[model samples]
Target: MVSMSKDTPRLDPAAIVTSAMRIADAEGLTAITIRRLAQEHGVTPMALYRHFRDKDDLLDALAARLLADIRLPAPTTAPWDEQIRAVLAACLAVLRPHPAVAGLVPARILLSEPGLTLVERTLALLDEAGFAPDQATEIGSQALCSLVTLVATEPGAATENTDPDTRDDVIRAKRAALRALAPQRYPHILAAADALTLCADRDNYYDLGIEFAVAGIRGIRPATRTSG
Candidate 1:
């Protein structure tokens, strides 16, 4: 380890990124700016620029931070599909807490070391599952994008109000509006009103979303590759 010296740059890149993530979690991606972060750190924008080129660099750093948090499941002799599921789950666990910045994932996944490791592992699993390198690249990208979209677009998730009571009220209002729609022409929608309006159980919502993703991949695999 390099010994600390008084000459060391006062601003830590990791520490600054952590603060930016916190700001994003509370406020929104649009709220993150070099000027704003500089104000938070009591430094001028040029000081922040030393660690980040600009806003885009900082955002990329945030995405790298999310990808770095993934606790990728250990390599196993388990079926490729099963291992892929575990990989997806690990990614979900990281991105769920920082939805605002999760949108940055697809653009940055190949740009970070941790993200590259994950992509490499995922592609290896796809190869084991019989997808050619080109196909695996496409499929892996789609699967990751699907997972990111799932977190970014979950119902009622974008709400600024985190208070449980306030959120419940909002859900109830939405449910009522859906139920109030004329039932004569929308019977199917009417029957599914509650499900349509509220993601009542977040865990189930994500579990089912993951299932949909896995099902799509399984359904598309070559019949000749069937394990059984």
Candidate 2:
């Protein structure tokens, strides 16, 4: 059977990936499929197959798109610590808006040109801060995991994705459930229930997560040695 209509816009990797991301953001990653995207675009699975061999390949393309959006910082004279922190922040900025697909990044970070560049730059900074090659690679992996997880687990993520009034209701219901616990038995939980349920300031929450990640890299930096 003929796959594409004469008037259908020619599908490309960029168009396919962008549509998949839109579906992922609004409906979650599991909702994306070659058939689903093809239907939406008035094309056929065969047309999409020209760009993505399967769902896994399409997801890899999505991951690469995320990496490509990262604005890697220029080489700077600043301390490695400062520059590394900036790199982490840049990655977060790109991934934060697409938490649904942010998790795809860590597994694919070494698989694309942009991702390879990011990994190389990150490893070089770690080396500048005194980590050996192996140590820097391991540390970069850990940092990648942490940054992706940061966005993926943001407080009330799915609920917060709703309309404002609905989101507030979800947050309030969660807070009430936590606060309803026996104060005497759950005093500490009650005390921090709001923070546990939701972050009042989204930017502040991310700022702290970035600082925590940076502090972790610094905390483990190699120490000066002395003569035995």
Q: Estimate, for each residue in 1-228, the C-alpha lDDT of model 2 and write its tens digit.
A: 336767777777798888999999988999998888888877878888888889999889999999999998898999998999899999999999998999999888888999999999998999899888778888889988898888888888877568999988999999999999999999999999998888778899898988998899999957453445
> Which runs of model 2 end up more than 4 angstroms from their true locations?
1-3, 221-228
Candidate 1 deviation (Cα RMSD): 5.2
Lowest-scoring 10 consecutive residues by lDDT in candidate 2?
219-228
Q: Local distance difference test, per candidate? A: 0.86, 0.88
TM-score of each: 0.89, 0.93
Model 1 per-residue lDDT tens digits across residues 152-192: 88878866447888878888888898888899988888898
Q: What TM-score, to 2 decimals, does candidate 1 have? A: 0.89
**Residue 144 CA error for candidate 2 (Å)?**
1.4
